[model samples]
Target: MPALVYLLVLMVIPLGLVIAYAFLTSGRFGGVQGPATLDNITRLFQPLYLEVLASSVVNAGLATFIAFLIGFPAALAITRLSLSWQTVALIAVVMPFWTNFLIRTYAWILLLNREGILSDGLALIGLGPIEVLYTREAVILGLTYAYIPLMVLPIYASLQRLDSMLLEAACNLGAGPWRRFRTILLPLTMPGIITGCLFVFIPSLGNFVIPELLGGGNSQMIGNLIRDQFLKSRDWPFGSALSLLVLALLVIIVMLQASAARRSRKWGA
Candidate 1:
């Protein structure tokens, strides 16, 4: 009951305000007005909103893939370590996540800019300085770095929970390393992979700080567009509609993943 109170008072109620604002009409002075209509939702279908959505999807997809590529191998290695060392390694992996996200993104900006550490390193290596900050790729890099811990933690947790005997049995049956990983290990750990992907992808899709700092306007994402509509452009209705649409898309993705997981589990059984 106490938790419920805190959740409602702190989270649900505030979210309800956003929901109400999203469905209502625009006010004369940029606030939301009642007597709502479908116009806000209709405006979300405009090419501008669609483009932002698409950019967000692509950028988030790229980031999620990169995070997976990095985190999975790391998770595998963590699981392979001595049990006593696994705890230390896991703590090290997650330590970066305790820092502020904005500061983390800014650190990347310092490293990737033309006058940044990367350029200095390049010059020392006799390679010409390269521009990096404030681009789509930079945004992807920032997001991937920011969320790697989140992805790895879940995957590592899942991998640690797995039965080692099953893997041993597969190895005894003449399964090569690649074959065992593909047929046995990958299947068992897919839930963690999916969970990690969702954790990275959903937030990346709606992320404002990384894109705003590292991507600039050139790589505007859905979250930026939504912010612009409400705060910059003062289009409350449109912003609300955009928010709802993003939430809807997230819900759909979760549902699809859930269904796929259920099917996979059934088949595995």
Candidate 2:
């Protein structure tokens, strides 16, 4: 009863309000003004908003790919370690969470900024400083750094459960390292990969902080755009619509992920 009441008060009510707000008109001064209309939803398909959505998808996709590339090997390395060492390795991968998220992002800014560590290192190597800050790549890099652990943990969980005898059997059959990984390891660990991708991709798509701090105004994503609608533009109706759109998207992605996980388990069985 308490749990149901909590859900009703916290989740249902707020979602109902947002849904109501999405249909209402925004006042000239701010807040809701008139009767509900579909204008806000219609405007979502406008070219400008569409572009932002597309770019957000692309940036998130790239971040997920990069995280996977970096994380899969890290997870494998952890799996190879002794049991005690495995715990340490896993802790190291998630150690960044011990610090504040904003602080960690600021650390990336210090490294990527002109006259910062990266630039200084380049100069020492006789290479000129590269402009990276306030760019799409910078945002992607920050996101990848922030979420790589999400990728690693899931894949590690999957890989850790794998039987060693399977690998030994594959080897005895003359399967090379690549063949063992491709035919055996890859298929078995796919659930973790999919879960990791969903974890990284969804958050990356909705994240404004990395883009705001690193992307600057030019590379604003959907989250930033929605923020602008509510704060800067004073367009509450549009903002609500955008929020609902994102909520709908998240629901769809979660469903798809759940379905994928079920399929993976079936394949594993």
State the lDDT at 220 in candidate 2. 90
Would you estimate the TM-scores of all the predictions? 0.92, 0.95
- Looking at model 2, which ten-residue stretch has the lowest summed lDDT? 260-269
Give one clash count per candidate, in the order shown.
0, 0
Off by over 4 Å in 1: 10-12, 264-269
Best model number under TM-score: 2
Root-mean-square deviation of every model: 2.0, 1.5
Give a tens-digit lDDT track for model 2, residues 6-102.
9999999999989998999999977997887999999988998889888998999999999999999999999999999999988999999999999
lDDT of 1 by residue, 1-269 (tens): 99999999998997787788877888877998789787777777889778889889999999999999999999999999998899999889888878887787788989999999998899889895988898889999999998888899889988987899989999999999999999998888888899999999999989888889998778899899889888888988788778888999999999988987896688543
Model 1, 46: alpha-carbon shift in Å?
1.1
User: What is the TM-score (0 to 1) of candidate 2?
Assistant: 0.95
What root-mean-square deviation over C-alphas does model 2 reach? 1.5
Cα lDDT, all candidates? 0.88, 0.91
